[model samples]
Target: MTQDAQKDSSTYWKKSRVELRAAGFDPDRTAKTTAVVTIASAWTNAHRCNNRVRGIADLLVELLAERGGQGLVVGAPAVSDALTQGTPTAGYSLVSRDVVADCFEIGHYAHHGDAMIVISGCDKTGAAALMPLARTNAFGLVLYPGTSSPGKVSFEPWAAKGTNLTIMDYAEGRAAQEAGRISAAELVELERNVMPGSGTCGAMFTANTMSTTAEAIGMMLPRGASHPADYDAASDIHADVRAQARASVEALYRLMEAGIRPRDIMTLRAFENAITTVYAMGGSTNMYLHLLAIARAAEVPLTIERIQEIGERVPLISNLQPHGPYAMTSLHAIGGVPVVMKELLRAGLLHGDVMTVTGRTLAENLAATPTLEEIGKQDIVRPVGQPVAPANNHISVLRGNIAPESCVLKLSGKTLEKGEFRGTARVFDSEADTMKAIRAGEIKPGTVIVVRNVGPVGGPGMPEMVMLTIQLQGRGLGEDVALITDGRFSGVSHGILIGHISPEAARGGPIAAVRDGDTIVIDPGQRTLNVDLSDAEIAKRMAEWRAPDPAGRLRPGSVHDKYVRLVSSAHYGCVV
Candidate 1:
């Protein structure tokens, strides 16, 4: 070994020996001394999504020991967006991503681990897990605990006769109840069955989107992003995931032996691959923020503008989740993300030469993988030529007087059909007020909902407004109205909406000056969002505009306060 390598090995031995001894292991007798940190969100009743992570971590620790490596489990904080949605507690959700990354970073530093294994299952965990691995440039891989099995539910008269249900269905069920289309007991039944067991949400929301992103970013093993979470080794149907878990452990050793690290795998091209995957697969808007944060951690120059540039060239091919008629499990049943990646590769949309944690190029790993056509005659992942939405037809990055830095608009089928919206503004300062207006049936068609003072610094977390959008769909006015916010929306949120408006209201952006009945236009084809008011009028309004009194929500120097102080604008990925 080189002199520096020898010194590093010696230091690792001394540091690990002490930790092993403290944990009741005889240092000299133990042949394995290399510390391998396994970062996981410990089991919690807050949500089923994270309850599987601890078990995966335990499995990793045992497997690492069998392979002559000393493994240590590190707990990272996690929050459920579904559970916290629309509540003040929602302020803690995005903050948890940065907190989880910090926890993993501290744990790696404390253990002096040369390698890491992160098992993730929540909306934030996937991105949080990757940020530290990239920052540290360690030999590590991310394991998605897999998607939760779709829940079974039946609705009559008001809805379809399907059994598949997800959290999105449950959220919209409440809206159905409010609209008198469904009974409260029907909504209750949906709540009980929407999420049956452990794993991430069953749809193409933030969790599953980021899970796919990890693999495409070259931080996860092949075929690791889409397996069902409840499957066991005894079942023939789940044998692939069992083998995937075992293969990951084996790949870890190979990566270590080759001195390959996450940075070596997560290159600019890899980030581009990830962006292409997100666009092709109908991924969440949250992926934009998460990818930006992770790219910053990896010291990559991945910008929201670059993400839009990639989205412009890649077609939305996957027919899944809030945008389509399928769940993530349907894609898994047919071949998972590799099927989509292979199609992109064939169409020259992906960087197939990027390195991956498997100690091979992405193209090499996918060489033998089956495509959607070969897996079956499934339409879950459409061929690139027969895309769900053409390039630049899905996600539009818009800049206007309202969002000078930029904002994201998720163009759905209905929105694309209409092409443009010019409506009078129906302004609200918070999600709660908007929810109240929606419930009261005060919101009308041809109304552009301008919700400001809820940006990163404004909301102190940039909480998602899924409840509002879902209710609009439930109210039968989804296509007729548009929502604009400096905050964000859930991946499950659809309809004509724009989010992540930078120069947010809290920082005196033009959105703060918007008043009820002002004319606003949203044109996807032109890629612009603008209010009809003059620039001088907007400037005059901003000159007199005052920020809301945050003292009601923010505690001095609390985590939220710190996040508010450090977090950047949404256009920049809202990084701290």
Candidate 2:
């Protein structure tokens, strides 16, 4: 705490008169409450998105000071990254959720501020910030730093270069090299600048997906999802992102005065709106996982089945990618979430009356937001009637012998065109083994890739398999194969992938019983996933199954180590 802030605190208990005057009220009679501003952010520059978090935090400090409120930045744990294919925070020294949970818990218990501005950049941080906000029921606002702009890189033959070559396209680059299409030097060059600067990966990946959900659920202001980190502070709309920081904090101040809390906006009806919005946008599979966690915090009952129920009715209207060809930057061009939500509201898919942080209803926010007519027309966000995927919302809740609790399938991206897949299981206990087999071209066309011992309990953090999925895509075998796991997939993962299976292999689920060459079938039309074996035969096989020895995992004293022992199935949102 600063000396000035300490002095300000001394008088805060008796400052009704002073605050009334500062708020433009007649001090003689007006009773205005002072709002202490707390700034929470994950500000590490390990990624470009983190830079935006830091910048926003600094900007909030300045804005709150101008508003005559004392503010201080609270340090939160940044999800340390090393390798991701194994588990969510596999290679990192810290267990991500444990760190993130503590970050919010500390702030909530400390009562650092009456009103808070949560500044987070990426996927996990959003969930971390969200849970405690709901738990504390504080008057606060969540602001994302925004998606990063696409960096340019060039490869050959497959058009994986320039704005076309996102970091995720590195997998495609590798495939091109092995096919003798691109040279080794070209591959190196593409990897070098695939991510030119900071932002999240250039797809509807976890970061973008969570940010979009935040806006859809009314926890954030409209159109904050797709703005590129704009490190230069210049966004496509309004002014620089710095101005957005100021505006967001100001909104927080106003909401505090109005006595609005996060619980008011994130109601059961609002969760439905969020679920519907996610389906319409072909959002991240991680949504199923994180939304479950957030819903648990908010005391809302939600599950993959309920989510798929919404998906069954809503159409996948946007053509955004890691599944499609467009990026967050493209969404920004046509108008961001406001335009998209407006169209969804027109379809009666979202709760237009849900309240938001800005003290406006969802309908009012969309109505006030200028559309593509003012921003210049674009087709990035398609009409509901003529969507990218009209048959389904690109989300499937599969239940069968394989996943009793239910598994989620994202049929968006390139995976949309595929039908039922029946293939032999090529089981690998870890993502590294799967990646190795993929690089060696040992995987067959009718393969059902199974990576086990990496779910919530075994993986202990349930990492998203971005590298493996992208590698499969690069090999030109994306739709030809099916990957299922107890862990999860990145939003960019397309092509017949199933994840978030309950009773993970480590817990002696059916997945542990499977041997090499066991047949697996995924029928999207029926929303079923099963292995070709009799129930008794499956039972006999599982009777002999055993979890991998945990000698090499995070040590016993570590939080990750503790998680392996206490975390529930992914079916339970992986909560402890």
| Deviation (Å) of 573 in candidate 2 | 0.9
How far in Å is the alpha carbon of 137 misplaced in model 1?
A: 0.3
Give candidate 2's TM-score: 0.89
Give lDDT per model, in order.
0.81, 0.72
The prediction achieving the highest lDDT against the true structure is: 1
- TM-score winner: 1
- Candidate 1: give the clashing pairs: none
Candidate 1's error at 386, in angstroms?
Answer: 1.2
**For model 2, how does the per-residue alpha-carbon lDDT over 1-576 read when each residue is reduced to its tens digit?**
432443244244335667646856455432232556667787885655566676677777777767766555777766633235445355332246546756765764464456667776667786666776776666777788766566565434424433634556666677667756678988887777665556666667777788888889988777777777763324332244666677787788778778778889889889899888877788888788778888888788787667777767887877777667677777776677777788888778888888999898888888866654455556677778877877464777888897888888777834434567889999998888888898888997989999888787777677777677777777788878889998778776777789988788888888787778899988888888898999999898887776677786778788777777777777767776
* Model 2 regions more than 4 Å off: 1-33, 80-83, 86-95, 153-165, 231-239, 370-377, 391-393, 413-418
Candidate 1 residue lDDT tens string, 1-576 = 232442264346444667768988777755445545554444565677776666666677777777767676788777888788899888788888989999987777665566778877788888898998888777788888778777767665224524446778877778888899888889888888776656788888899999999999888887789888775322222445566667888988898788788889888999999999988888888888999999999899998889989888888899887778677887877778999999999899988888899899999988998866777776678888998877876677999989899999987433455668999999998899998998898999989999988888888799998888999988888889899999988888998889999889998889998999899988888889999999999999889998788887789979998898899888778889
